[model samples]
Every structure is written in structure tokens, then in C-alpha cells.
Target: MNWLTNWIPKIRSTKSSSIPENLWHKCNKCGEMIFKQQIEDNLLVCTICDHHERMTAKQRLCAFFGSEKCFVVEEPKKYSDDPINFTDKISYKSRLKKYREICDSDDCFLIGIGSVEGKKVVALSMNFKFIGGSMGRALGNAIVYAADLAVENGIPLIIFSSSGGARMQEGMFSLVQMARTTIAIKQVKEAGLPYISVLCDPTTGGVQASFAMLGTITLAEPDALIGFAGKRVIQQTIRVELPDDFQSADFQFNNGFIDKIVHRSKMRSEIIRILDILD
Candidate 1:
């Protein structure tokens, strides 16, 4: 027992009573404090309670694959920044450059296949950190690729959707991506493969209008804000008192907008079971 106890670090002395400073992140949904690195290792899940934190597309992909073996959906072909160059907003080139510096990628989505709890499947990961995971050309392309991969590999697909909606900078072309994504997912349904979508915090706009809702099974993290318009806008439009938790994950679950409200700890295992049922 003494030998086993030797591994514990010995404290030289008690320090000042002041609490140690810990870095914190303000959750978009609940406005809670979240520790940074600890959350990363825990699938970006909040440690205090188990709320699913917003994740970047890259971080999400890495967690899903669990390694690099997952086939990457390479940068799309026929993609261009200036679908229509406009000086009214930031120039296409400048916006791209800014996003590139922050996100280090042009795409808001990553689609590919790999094993999770021993079941193989295709998956799409949306990065909330990147321009609010707006569904632009890159996102639409990734969805299409995931659907195609499911058809090609004979595996079901799962998408973790956390986005704000369309990329307005791209104009009408951005809106078109919604149609393209919906049609692409139709291929998966036609192929007789299961398509599951896990909606995290704040899945809205063009994404909500299209593929996010098309999933045969739509799952949402508890208390996520799932809607098209801001709460303020809704109140202004309706001119009435909204429910205490209107548009929240729990509300959606009760209203049939969400199929299931899942916890972060059980997510991977739940996905595994879904894949098993499909197989």
C-alpha cells in the first residue's frame, strides 16, 4: 500500500487562499462557463453538467473518426469564392481570406466514413466556430459528398448539424445549396440507407429548411436552440408571449421537431446502436 501511495505528488506547502483562474467559454445556448482544453478532450462537452459544446468542423471530424483512417471528403471541385463578387459586403476574396485565417479552411462541413464502437458509417460534422457553421457552397458540397459516400460504401450516414444557416455573402447561390443538399440526401433515402442527423445548439436558417430536417431520425442535444429566426424576431412577428423555453431542444422534442433528446456521454453509443439497426 505504501509503494502504491508513493506515486502521489507531495505538496511542499499550502499556497494563498485565492482560487486559481480557469479559462472559460460562454456557451451559445445557455451562456454557461466552460473550461477550454478539458472540453476538447471530452468531445467539446461541458464538464460541469454535460451540455454539448459548439465544435469546429475539424474538431468534430477528428472526434468522429477517432483517428485519420476516415476517408476525407476532399475540398470540392468547381468551388469558387466569388459566386458573385459584391462590394456591398466584404469582397468574396477578402471574406474568404478572413475565414481562412480563423478557420484555416473554406468549408464549414466535413463528410467521411469510419468506425464508431465497431460500426462503420458515413458522417457529416458542422463547425459552429466557423462563421457560425453557415451552410454555404462548401457545406452543401460536404452534405452531397456524405450522401454519395453512403450510397457508394453501402453504409448509413450520420450528420452532426450545428449551424446558423445560409451564408448571406454568397447571395442566391447560398440559397441554392439548400436545394442541392436536400436532393443529395434523397439519394441516401432512395438507396435504402439510414440517415441520422444530430442537431446540436443553434441549428437554424437554410440548414433547418433543408437537410437538417430531412434526416429519418432527428436527434438534438438537450436545451439546444433549434430555430430559423432569432427569439426577438419571433416575438416581434407574433406580438405575443412566447413559451419559457420556446424553440429549445426540449420544446422541439415535445413538439415533434426533434425525435430524441440525447446526452453527450451517450451519443457515440447511441449512434452505434442506430448503425447496428441499419446493418
Candidate 2:
């Protein structure tokens, strides 16, 4: 049998330009096309529509640091690789290997310290683009370590939650992160430092069940999804249709699950206000 590679085109032409495409992402609110780097500079907010797009953990840290002068707390590197050799529709190891080569990150979490609006704050961002932002042991460790560091420094802890929930590859190990992260947030709270969690689009599953819900002042992007379980799953179990905006930021705000619903343009001011109030 001939391999699929045999059918590939033999004639190839090289382009003259080498510059990468200035990629653009559309805003869900006002349907505006935003430059990726510009959006990132504005804390992932669409400049035209003020729509907030969820960013990678590293990107979030960079924005927090660039916007506010602060230092970083270097946490230990996290673990990666398939623990159980898991396979669903695809092989976990195979997928991991491919992404590893592409993204070069084994885990989905990154923790760093920075100032938000001139107030010292710790940040933890969940990289949703990486394996759907699945939380593994290293991610859990980063969360715990960040929380502990915040407590040690007597500063606020801020976490950007954007995840598909626990990593299927880690099995029970991933499930344990829920508790690990929650306990870490509590550790910060016990020290009397504010714990602010930002719920980005699709903050659900293990993330919503843990520290995302326990923030001393929880803030969510306009129209973010925040919930422990999905609406469809809940509806199927309860045999009833859910509200139109179930698990949305509006729903969470109305139900008092979150402190406020802030737009991307107003996020900096809102965070500063929270810091002032806490101070």
C-alpha cells in the first residue's frame, strides 16, 4: 500500500516575505477586528468594542507587569506527560507530544507576581489554548505556591480563570487540583489579604468549583461563562431547560456569585478601586 505522503505535491515555491501574519481576533460583543498584539497590550481587550478575550497565563502576567510596576515570584516548574497513557478519540501521549513540540509547555498553568494599577498582586493565568487549559499537578502546585506567596507578602492574589476543567490524562490526580487550589485561596484569605479572581470566557468545571468562586472580590469579563457544571449537563440531569444566560456573568452577578461585571475598558479602574477599598 502507498503511504498518504506519496500523494503530496512535489513542486513547491518559496515566498519572498518572511514576516508572520499580523493575526486578528474578532470581538464577540461589537464584532470588531482587533490586532492580536494590540489587544494583548490592552489586557486582551478589543479597543473598538471593549470586548475582553481570554489570554494565556503568560500573556496575562506580562500585561499585569507591564501595566503596573512589580516583581515576580518564580515558582517551581510543573510536571507534564501522560500519567496513564490515556486515549480517547486520540492518543493522549501522541497529542501531548505534538503540542509539546508546537507549544513547548508541558503544563497549562503559569504563576507570577505583578502590580495591578500600582497595587501589589499575585497572578495565576490558565492557558486555555494549551490543551483546553486543563489543570494538572504542576498547575495545582503553581496555584498553591502563588497563594502562599501572596500570604507571605501580605498582598492580594489575582487569578485569571479560563479552563475546560481537569485534565483527563491525569485522571484522579487532576481532580485533586480542585481542592488544592481552593485550599490555597483560603490560605491567602486567612492571612487577611484580598483574593480577586477574574472569570474569563468559559471559566467552568474544576476551576469554577474552586478558587474562582471563593474570591473576596470576584470579577468577571462581560458575558463570561462561570459555573461548576455545564448547563446542558444540568438540564439533562434535571430534565428541565435552564435560563437563557445560565452560568453567564450576568447570571452570576444577579445571583451574588460575583462581586461585579466589569467591561474590559473599565477593568483597570475597577481593579484599582478594589485595591483601594481593600487598602
Candidate 3:
């Protein structure tokens, strides 16, 4: 076990200084090398291409609410672990343990009660790093509870959606979340509170079909992928070719699926402005 963990550092060491591999980041869009600190300062957007990189749920919370104001809202109820006893290459339980450790979250969804620019809000964000932000029973339960909390407190709700879709491991139980989350958002809407959704990159599949698209005001990061089906699959199914930028956020906004395409730099102020209007 010690050998498995210790071999890499020894292999990469140099005579003068250890290589700082994590000190720099390469922009996925522009292929530009940027300092990790610079990326952090820019809220993880690529400085050159202005590409909005996926951020952890905690990072999203920090960006919106800052450390002092944000308080995590506990899930109202815990869901069963390995409800399906699913296993592929590895057990679903093992996968959960791995992602829980990596993302520092019990599930992909992070729900928090916080004030954004002095207005109290319930913020729900997805961490794509955890199982591609897959919507499972825990996440479904979290969203429903968060919606209830927002309604109970008379506060608005905002969800930052960055997901690859439903968790296949949970089978039909995962697909059912599409309805559960949709109904949850409706509860918030019925309370006459604003429900805003910020669609991040790769917001697709069951999530896009559900609460992610049910926002009162739908906003997306520039150039993010916003679609239900993959381009290749759609083209194949329809037996026709698709536009090069068919599923891009800009394309979706032009086609009216999104209300606005916001840049990462102005996201905080834009959200605050909207909250102020609805306040």
C-alpha cells in the first residue's frame, strides 16, 4: 500500500526541485498555459479564451456567497446507499466512496443557505467532478428539500447545473428524479419566489430535461453545452447532419432556450441584479 502511494513522487523528482505539476493549468479551449493562481483569481475561467471551466460545488458557493456568508443546508433526509446493489467494473458503493473523498461531498449536489449581495437565497450547485454530477436519489432528495426550505423561508432559489445527466447505476430510480426535481421547483415557484438556474458546461440528459430547464430565468455560461441529446446521437437518429455549434449555449440562447448567456466575470453581479429586481 505504501509503495502504491509513494512511487509517483519519487519517479518525478528532479535534482534541484520537485516538479510542481499542479501549479499551472492548460486551457482546454485555447490551449493556453496559465498559472493556477491566475485561474483561481479569474474564477477558473480561461484568461485567454474566456472559457468557463467546470467548478466544484463548494467553489461555486464561494463565488456566489463567499466564505463568511455561506452556510451549508443539510439534506432533510438521507437516501439509501446502493439502493440497486449496482456494480459494473467496480461497486457503486466503492464509486461513491471514491468521489466522496475526492469532491469532499457526500453527493454531487451541494445545497447551501446564503446571502448573495445581501439577499438571502438557497443555492444548489452540482459538482461535475463527482460522478459527472450525476443525479441520483440523494441529489433528488437534496433538491426537493432545498426547494422546500426556500419555500418555507420565503427565499429565492438558484441552482448551478453542470451535469452529464442521470446516474445509470440507479436505473429507473435515477430517471424518476427528473419528476421529483421538477415538482420540487414548482413548489418554489408556487411560493412566488424566483428560481434561477445557471447552466454550466455539459448540462445534458435527465438533468436538462428536469429542473435545470425549469428555471424562471434560465441563464448559461458562454459556449457551454446545453442540450438533451448528444449531437452524434441526434444526427444519427434524425438521419441528417447538425450545425457545428448546434448545442452550444450561444446557439441555445439564439434559439430561445436560454434567457441570457452570461460571462463568468459578470455572473455574480448579474445574479445579484436579477435578485434585486425580484426582491
Q: Identify the leading candidate in terms of TM-score.
A: 3
Q: Model 2: clashing residue pairs?
A: none
How well is each residue in 152-182 modelled by candidate 2, as lDDT tens digits?
A: 8898888888888888788998899899988
Model 3 regions lying over 4 Å from their true place: 1-21
> Which pairs clash inside model 3?
none
Q: How accurate is candidate 2 locally (lDDT)?
A: 0.79
Local error of candidate 2 at residue 177 (angstroms): 1.2
Which portions of model 2 miss their true places by more than 4 Å? 1-20, 23-43, 47-50, 67-73
Give the winner by lDDT: 1 or 2.
1
Candidate 3 whole-model C-alpha lDDT, 0 to 1: 0.90
- Per-model TM-score versus the true fold: 0.84, 0.83, 0.92
Cα lDDT computed for each candidate against the true fold? 0.79, 0.79, 0.90
Ranked by lDDT, the better of candidates 1 and 3 is: 3
Candidate 3 has a TM-score of: 0.92
- In model 1, state the lDDT of residue 211: 92
Report the lDDT of model 1 for residue 188: 93
Q: Estimate, for each residue in 181-206, the C-alpha lDDT of model 3 and write its tens digit.
A: 99999999999999999999989999
